[model samples]
Target: MQQISINTPALLFPAITLLMLAYTNRFLALATLIRNLHTKYKQGQEDRNLLRQQIKNLRRRLLLIKQMQASGITSFFCCVLCMLFFYIGYEGWAYGIFGLSLGFLLLSLVLSLNEIYISTKALEIELKDME
Candidate 1:
C-alpha cells in the first residue's frame, strides 16, 4: 500500500464532525416527537391504534439514530487513530485504520438513510390519521 500522509485522515475531521452534528439534530427531533406523543397518549387525544403505530415507528427510528451516532463516533475515533498512527510512522497501520474509519462512515450513512425512510413513514402515518 502506498504511504498516506496524516493529512488524509485529518481531512475527515470536519466532515465527521458535521455528520455527528446532523445526527444529534435528528436525535433531538425524535426526542421532541416522543415527548409530544407521550403527552398525547396521556391525554387520550390520539386514536389507540394510531398511537400504537406511531410509537412503534418512533421506537425503530430512535434505535436507528442511536446506531447511526455510534457508527459515526467510531468512524471519527478511527480517523483520529489513523492520523495518530501515521504521525508516529506506522503507515500500514494508519492505512488499515483509515479503511475502518471509512467503513464505519459508510455504515453510518446507510443507517441515516434508513432512518429517513422510517421518518417519512411516520409522517405518512400522521397524514393518514388526518385524512
Candidate 2:
C-alpha cells in the first residue's frame, strides 16, 4: 500500500496546477491594472481614491501568491527528501515529510482562498464605484 501510494504523485498535480493558475491569474490582472494606473497617473488624471484602493488590493493578492509559491517550493523539497530517505531505508522520515506536505498544502489552500476574497472585494468596490 505504501509503495503504491508513494509511486503516485498524481494526487498533488491537480492541486499544484490549480494553485499555479490562480496565482497566474492574479498576477496578470495586477499587471493590467498597474499598466492602466500608470497611464492614468502619467496623464495626471488618476482617480486617487480608486487608485489607492486598487494598489492596496494588488499588494494583498501579491503577498498571498508569494506565500503560496514559497510554501509550495518548501513542500516540494520536503517531498524529495522524503523519497530519498525512503530509498535509503529510513522509513521513519516519511512521517515527517508527510506532515510537512500536509502543512504546505493547507497553507496553499488558505492563500488561494485569501486571494479569492481579495479579488471579490476589489471587484465589488470597482463595480459600485462611480468614478
Candidate 3:
C-alpha cells in the first residue's frame, strides 16, 4: 500500500461539511412543513388521513436524516483519526481508518439519496391534491 499523506484525508473535510449543511437544510424544511401542517390540522383545514400520512412520511424522513448525519459525523471522526495515525507513523492503522471513513461516507450519501427520494414522493402527494 502506498503511504498516504495527511492531506489525503484532509481533502474530505470540505465535502463532508457541505453534505452536513445540505442535510441540515432538509431537516429545517421538513420541520417547517410539519409546523404548517400542525397549524392546518388545528384549524380543521387539513384532511385527517392525508395529514397522518404526511406525518408518517416526515417521520421516516427525519429518521433517515438523523442516520445520515450520524454516519457523516462518524466518517469525519474516522478521517481525523486516520490523519492522527498517519502522523504517528501507524501506517496500517491509518489505512484501515481511512477505509472505514470512506465506507461511512458512502453510507451517509446513500441515506441522503434515499431521503431525497422520499421527499420527492411527499411533494408528489401534495401536488396530487392540487389536481
RMSD of each: 0.8, 2.6, 0.9
What is the C-alpha lDDT profile of model 2 across 1-131, one tens digit per residue? Answer: 34523544345656666766767777787778778878988998867888888889888887887887778766666666666666777777765785687688778778878888988998887887865
Candidate 3 residue-wise lDDT, 28-78, digit = tens: 998999899989988999978788789989999999999999999999999
TM-scores for the candidates: 0.97, 0.82, 0.96
Model 3: lDDT of residue 43: 97
Rank the models by lDDT, top first: 1, 3, 2
Better of 1 and 3 by lDDT: 1
Clashing pairs in 2: none
Reference-based lDDT, residue 68, model 2: 79
Model 1, CA-based lDDT:
0.94
TM-score, cand. 1 vs. native: 0.97
